[model samples]
Target: MITKVTHGWRPGGLVAYLMGPGTVEEHVRPRVIASWDGLDEGWQPDTGPGGALDFQLGRLIGALQVPATRAGLPVSGQAPPGRGYVWHCSARLSATDRTLSDEEWAGVARRLLDGAGIATTEDLGGPRWIAVRHADDHIHVAAVLVREDTGRRFWPHHDYRGLRCTARELESELGLTPTALADRTAARRPQRAELELAARQGVEPARTELARVVREAAVAATDPGGFVDLLRGRGYLVELRRLPSGDPIGYKIARRATTPIWFGGGKLAPDLSMPKLITRWGQRGDATERLDAGVLAETRQTLERAERILRGARQGIAAENPDGIAHAVGDVVAALGARYGGALGEAASCYDGAARAPYEPVPDVGSVGSELRTLAGYLLRPRRRHRDDLDALSTVALLVALAALVQQIAQWRAEQGKRHQATAARDAQRLIRCTAEERRPRRGPPRPRYAREVAVDHSRRENAVAAIT
Candidate 1:
């Protein structure tokens, strides 16, 4: 499903546009699916003697604007910009999905209103809203931003997040295509206008592309100077938000374009914010060091040591804040993705959300997480070709071990009641395992693990992906 939200100053105009003749987006028999008053029908005003559908539009418009008007606002005049007294949301189902009945759309409308705290059952003071379905696949929800009981303006907090959260549940219950849960720190999504613009320009949305570039740079960077240089080397227009004393505080980047759109690190992800990055990279002090790529045996040993600490250390990840450790682990996975971009890259990107810390900054504080951060740097450094039997075996073992580590994190997340993170981690694990199974035969000597196919749980995931071998 696709949802678009906007604030409008004119509630009557919005209501008219939604119910108007199919001028832009096609509107079939436009009818109210749901409303604040819980009316099924008959509430709509009858046409006047002039025979125009819009003749009695004022009747309904006046009704919708009651709360706003009572709150010292004009009856039909527009409010100031950005302080629009109306919230308009348009929701459309995928073309491949089945058409829902009016009753189902009503339920969806009610759920969305309640989820966003715009309205709730038995709450007389909530905002007055209506869901109008003008087409087979879409509905527009119009709401007056005033409490009916209190007659005071009410601005919703985290409305988009709440709407999407409820959307995930609705998609699942309605047997529609499932969307990835926005259950991590990186939850900024492109708006419908942005998506449309990107489509027209034949390019990725600025936000999405910049996020990937910034994240990859963050993983590879050794220090603040190196991080800036890395982005500059990639030809991005980089600028820093600095303190009055000339020390840098935050940063923003833009891709090379005729007119560039700059984004701050926080806009990309909470952890990617400048302060968080500085705090994190500052701890891993060796800025110019690189791992010995030829030492495959030593690499395996390092991974083994990481495994032991991850599995059995006295002050393990869970004892402290696990976000830092999760962030470090995700960095390693991201480096691997950058190293081999293909299906592996897809898997890595899919898992990115799972690795994010919450909105709060979590500096990679402890030694155990520090070890993983070091490994991440090692992976970011260039690797030599694997030749001898020991090298090939070690290389293969490293991939398997890394996959196992991801699975372990997934299990830990599930145990901790992070359903979305757990699901994302498991999905990444499956994809990485699948990539290994598919590409290993061509790359090197085969193992029994790749020869045997494992059964996948169809109940858990809907997509038909390669099974872990």
Candidate 2:
């Protein structure tokens, strides 16, 4: 399992993201795990058209704010009363364990919350929080940072490290496959300014682009010197750091000759560091043996086609053109299915179908692919009133699913062979950078004045259907 934690300032945004169908498909409704009153029933009421969930969320935030002001904490007057520290966590299980029941999944989530120091109010007199299960393999937990008994803020030191440790322990206890943990000791990753700049220029994020180039150069090089020279030839500024005895210790790379922003090797990834590279491939030897030229070319072409399809879908969604978005999403579903299906066929043909028998597609990819296909069906046959909401929801779901598929394909290819690793990494990075550019937080399109009325109408329709059923 893998765990990620993010700090936010608003609980409402988190709640809306989890409870609403925008990020998740309509078939997979989110399940509430915990709330302000510790109530387990009436999950549907909070999500009803009356805004009961938002109101309850407001009360919880209010409780936290009263204590914070009395404790003289830094409270911004411009922000809403409920606007404070919010920690959003996602704990994801392995794809192979997709058969786990809802009850079993919730049990795992509760245990994770307890282990991560968010289960009880004992530490700081209780903080209001909620856990919502969404998607297939993960659950999200949103918590306010202010303690109810004392208005003081709650910030856990070394929280990410603690979360990883807890995840590893849980993996063993739950008999789940263990995945890699991030190396916290490595150099910090580059900040987002360059990435945002790349977005503005209609290019891939600078960091990911540079990392991809460096990895490809490393794969093709005969030695460390060749690696540095290849990168320099490709418009990167490579600076190698060495010990007093002249042994290489680390390195920094920049996008251009004049750029002030340089990212350390370790910052790109732990394996990219000079020490790690040397340990794996040695100071002077072929980086890797080459694969068949025809096979490599075919793989690259397939990946490029997939990337283009996804990029078109992303662009359509960003422009908010519903018709164009639907067309592009359908293209993505077809392209991805063809790509994966072709690869599977090739594997089967190569070894008389035995080598491919054990190969299973990534769980997240399969789930998201199914959702996108279903979404396309809905987009083709839309209802009259819910067209706008359906468009937005399908767009968000497609974007989210596309991101996961890109990451999964990257990992899958890296495991295939050394020759395909660099190319796979580059394609994956390109897709990721493009998706990030499209989804970066910005001022959304203006809302209509009658938005509330439209929502009320939709809610009434839903309530009517519920009553009739």
lDDT of each: 0.73, 0.52
lDDT of 1 by residue, 212-303 (tens): 77877887887677889989998999998789997779999998889888889888766778887877777563443434544344445555
Worst lDDT 10-window in candidate 1? 450-459
- Highest lDDT scorer: 1
lDDT of 2 by residue, 1-469 (tens): 8888876665656666676665335415566755544463234334445552333344434543454456565444345555357778898888896455566665666566666676553453666666677578788777777677665677765667777777878788778877544333222344678767877879767676666556545434535787798788877889999899998888899876354578887677545678655643332222122323322232233334444544544444222222222222222333332223333222211111111111221112122233332332222222334333324433334444444545433343334332233243344335434544554456778889699789999999999999999
Clashes of each: 0, 1
Query: Alpha-carbon error at 223 in model 1, in Å?
Result: 2.2
Which pairs of residues collide in candidate 2?
67-151
Task: Please list the residue runs of candidate 1 whose C-alpha ends up more than 4 Å from where it truly belongs after superposition.
Answer: 1-5, 17-30, 37-40, 45-58, 66-83, 89-115, 119-127, 133-140, 147-152, 160-184, 285-323, 363-365, 382-395, 441-469
TM-score of 1: 0.73
Worst 10 residues of 2 by lDDT: 348-357
lDDT of 1 at 69: 77
